[model samples]
Target: MKINSFLLILLFILMSSVTSSSQAKEKAKHVIFIGLDGWGAYSVPKADMPVVKQMMADGCYTLKKRTALPSSSAINWASMFMGAGPELHGYTQWGSRTPELPSRVVNEHGIFPTIFQLLRDARPEAEIGCLYEWDGIKYLVDTLALNHHALSPDYTEKPEVLCRMAESYIKEKKPTLLAVCFDNPDHVGHGAGHDTPAYYAKLKELDTYIGRIVSAVEEAGMLKQTIFIITSDHGGINKGHGGITMQEMETPFIIFGKNIKSGGEFSESMMQYDVASTIASIFGLKQPQVWIGRPMKQVFK
Candidate 1:
């Protein structure tokens, strides 16, 4: 009888340990970051962006009420990646001029270590991939040395190429951290203006692209282990950003995935830098001391 009791206790202890380890592994979540360039809150109510709307309905969302300096792509993208403002990352505009250096874009130096670099340092086994417009990822990861792949240079053909590349990466690479950027809305908004038919068409195309990404993840059986975040770098007004207007500054923060609470919007004003900090926190990474923003803790349930 004593031997039987001892064996039962040992079994219980082993089961408990296994359960605890499974929970820990679940906590080690994967993240998919989608950056919609020139996407504004205005577009949300107007466009038939079903995927994004569904994400908002099923996940925690916050009104990202903030503005980017110079309202340029490079500056804001760097801020979002580094979790630091222009002052810290040292890229304040799309075209920046340093004394003694000719007027050049942010991609010229490409020396700063991005969030991916930090992730690599903390968890060397973690797989990371980036598909973006312009030099956002390159500047962040210092692609000059890392040999990181980008979609293409021409804006006209980039989105389609990006979709194909992302599909291939997700299927083959199974990255722990993946970031995809869509620039259609931003391009059309600049050329045709917001709320126009052209802008709406661009948004619809972008939504279709988003659906494809989600479908690929689901097919790979990674949906349950993935945390998806959809947001914009900054909004625009009259073909420009940087202005403090609500349409230009106030973006959306939509998050959905396993182990996340759903069905609510956060009213608190959050900055762009908070995105980087939140991502870092999600992976148990140390937030940069220089980052002034805090993680959106409300999303995790």
Candidate 2:
């Protein structure tokens, strides 16, 4: 009788462990990260972005999310994907195709470890895709880790075409991770100025593209299993960024769909590097010790 009771107790402990593991598993099967270049948080109030505004109303969002210092494109983009700041990842300049300084730790790929490489390592068969309007973005991600990647031949002029390509990719591949980067807003910001009418107008146009992408996800039948993360690298001033001003520092971070908390305005501080860690959390992958970013698990259900 004593041996039987001990066996039953062991069975109960095993069952409990299994249940706990099941409960702790991640809910999202796909994460679509949308990055808008030069999109500043300060412009949210006056800008006419109905689709993104609806996402903010229905999802977790914070307008106070900050970018890494210098607030330039390549530096912050590197931070957003590499899960560390310039001082650590070593991509410090505005259009850094390669690390300006030696990386603290580089993966076998010779570049600093990025979220894409982490996901690829954890899930070998997972589909990872990236479509970017700016050619510079290609240099930031691990192309060897991605299953599909494209650069817009039109450069930053047309975002709608990029959205169409994304739509097709979503329906066909049903990617585990997809990053769609639009550069038109930043292009307009540099040309006509950041706070000008053209910038807001470009945002409104981009909102339609965003809506279209969301619809495409639904059409591909991944909405219930997918999460949408909309964010930006930096905001700009009159016609430029890479400064200390709030407009150049603060950007919006929005997370929606698939077991995420609704209408959550996270007061907890978020930074650019946190985006990569959050993506890692969605995949149930452990972050490297070198990564300083923390997952916003507060937004998860």
Model 2's C-alpha root-mean-square deviation from the true structure amounts to 1.6
Clashes per candidate, residues 3 or more apart or on different chains: 0, 0
Question: Model 2 over residues 1-301: C-alpha lDDT tens digits?
Answer: 9999999999999999999886577669999999999999999999999999998888899999999988999999999999999999999889999998899999998989999999999889999999998888988898999999998777554557899999999999999999999986788889999999999999999999899999999999999999999999999999999999999999999999998889668899999999999999988889999999999989888
Residue-level lDDT of model 1, residues 131-186, one tens digit each, is 87655455554443322457546768555777777777888877788888877678
| Worst lDDT 10-window in candidate 2 | 151-160
Under the 3 Å rule for N, CA and C atoms, how many clashes does model 2 have? 0
Model 1 poorest 10 in a row by lDDT: 97-106
TM-score of 2: 0.95
Q: Global lDDT of each model?
A: 0.73, 0.92
> For each candidate, what TM-score against the reference?
0.84, 0.95
Per-prediction CA RMSD (Å): 4.9, 1.6
Off by over 4 Å in 2: 1-13, 19-23, 155-157
